[model samples]
Target: MFIFKLLVILTLGYWIMMLGDTLWARKLMRQLPASPKPGGSASTESFASAGLAQPRGTTAKELPLVSVIIAAKEEEASITETVKHLLNQTYPRFEIIAVNDRSQDGTGHKLEELRKWSQGKRQVEVPLTIIHVTTLPAGWLGKNHALYQGFLQARGQVILFTDADVLFQPHALADAVHYMKETEADHLTLTPKIVVNSFWLSAFVQYFFFALSLYIRPWRANIDSQHKHGMGVGAFNMITRQAYDRIGTHQAFAFRPDDDLQLGMRVKQAGLRQRLASGRTQLAVEWYKSLREAVQGLEKNIFSGFQYRVLPAAAGVIGQLLLFFFPFVAIFVLDGWVFWSYVLSIVLMLSVYSLLIQSLIGKIGKELLVFPATVCLLSYIVTRSVWLTLRQGGIHWRGTFYVLEQLKKMKR
Candidate 1:
């Protein structure tokens, strides 16, 4: 009986923390000022003149070159379309380097085809390069090794690391370059509109982004703060040459499979400015084909993202469950005054969640009803993810197993 009472009290306390966290997340979301217009000026303008020009009928001058590096491992299914998207960018001065990291499939062949296609097209102005990573360097993660090879061959002022599963709008480069120039951001990452084909996929993706907004307060993440250690999705990230050098490039985080997060941390450590943009207009990425892929993909990063700290990761999962599930459970289970209290909690939580959902939907063109379902599904994903991380120690990706070490050793 004592233990039962303690459990109830603990659950109530957890619910209160979740309520506060939800409110805090809402406040943080509100704190993120509206993004500047595509070419608007910020307080810093030393680099503003280098911003991308409006697409008018002017002969292409020597614009700052952009090097787009895609690291692929057996991505024959999607590499061709990804290359096509990058090659078709409105930004004239750019290069697309597709690094085939020893793909068993026809990824190398497809890259060759893309290279030939680009060379043959008189209309396509930007250069194209294909680098086949025959061997990965010791201590270097496969994707990072490919990116390193691409960097060595690239002569661009800005380097973009993107996945082979992404499709970009023509103006993506232009908008990103312009924003980078205006903000003088060393590393710029945009949250893409995740394309989901199935109902479960849609639910998972929606909730994933929603929960991310709560945990990784974008405004706070952008600036340099003590509590600002967070992760970046490597699907689409832009880094300037200077910032890349300052952070020691991929070499700094050679062994880390969670390269994006490590890179973001390095940038923060170097005191370089970073920015996270809403890429609804510019970028779209398909993360996983099925639920299994999604789970595995998340498991790989969940531990690494937390720097291999089991306690924090577990806490995060528990907190997420309470936040997402408490309201519904309260609605069904509570009575009288307890029911009213539950109702108040649910209303507050839902109001905040609804705002975030509406904002995301307005940007990404997703249905409104998807948000509720996502909340429940995300809770399950988080719980399962925690279990997998604790049991397996890491996740498998692209035929490579990323082994998770103890939290203390993760910094190495």
Candidate 2:
């Protein structure tokens, strides 16, 4: 009972911290410039007046070629929509490089169809290069290898690396370029708006984004250089070619599961500016189908983040239980003011979670009020993930079995 109380108290404290962080982030975002879509009501002069003009060193006549590269492996479910959205982007003088990494589905065929159809009736051609990566090198991860191939093929002043599932708005690329130029950022990553179609997906997404928001706190990424860390989202990483050349591109992050993060970190460590922002309304991605799928997908990231250490992974499970689940368990064991206080904390927790969810995704159902239950659910998922990783001896991502020992060494 004492332990439970302590847990509840700790959770409440964490929530208070998260609340402050959220408010600060909101304030920072409000101060930042908003990138208007081309043909929108906001004129170029208005953007300049709003302090959201194009990069200081460049004009419309000298716009650089931006290459958008996607690495796909068995992403047939959403690749079409993703590629189509890229084709619809308002950003001019850009090319799409979609690499199909030995897909078992029709992803390659779909890319071919889009490329050919767009090329057949275009004035200056669709400018989409569909590369087929049939061989995965002995030591490289499939996705990383495909990305390296795309990087080798790209010939642009800017590179946009993204996932095959992410859908960009008509002005997504345009806005990103503008932001990059304005900040003179070598690397800029925008967190996508997660769209959930099912109840379970919504719950999982809530937990995921809440954890990410608490951890990342995007607002402070550029401001706090003392921490000296940076993050990149696969949905949107706009990197100048100079930074890529300086940091060795995907080769710098090859064989790592968290390629985006490591890449961003490398850019910052190299004294290159790395900016982060929310693409809440400008971009969207349905990350996973269900909690099970999410857990399956999280194997690499969890272990990689933990440096393949079983002890730390187990501790994470314990932390999740205490931080998220204990308040509910405390109810049955306590009484009077103590219990009521715990209940109040629970209300605070749920309210914070609901607000975060509403802002990040959409509305939540009454069924989701049982927020503490999700903690217990996530505890199980995380525990199972650790056990599965140890049992299988490593992570099996995209038909490749990466050994645990090797993953641990990757930390160095």
Estimate, for each residue in 1-412, the C-alpha lDDT of model 1 and write its tens digit.
4543443455555556656665554443321122233243453232233244433333335456889989999999999998898877767578888899989999999999988888899987678889888876556678888989889999999999999989988778878876777677778887776777887776676667667766765545554555346446687778999889988988878777678877776777777888776676677888888867887677555656566666787787777666556556656765665566556666665555566655554443344355556665655666666677668776565666656553335455
> What clash count does candidate 1 reach?
0
Clashes of each: 0, 0
Mark the 10 consecutive residues where model 2 has the least summed lDDT. Answer: 37-46
Q: lDDT per model, in order?
A: 0.70, 0.75
Residue 54, model 2: lDDT of: 53
> How would you encode candidate 2's per-residue C-alpha lDDT over 189-222 as one tens digit per residue?
8877787677766776678667665655555557
Native-vs-model 2 lDDT?
Answer: 0.75
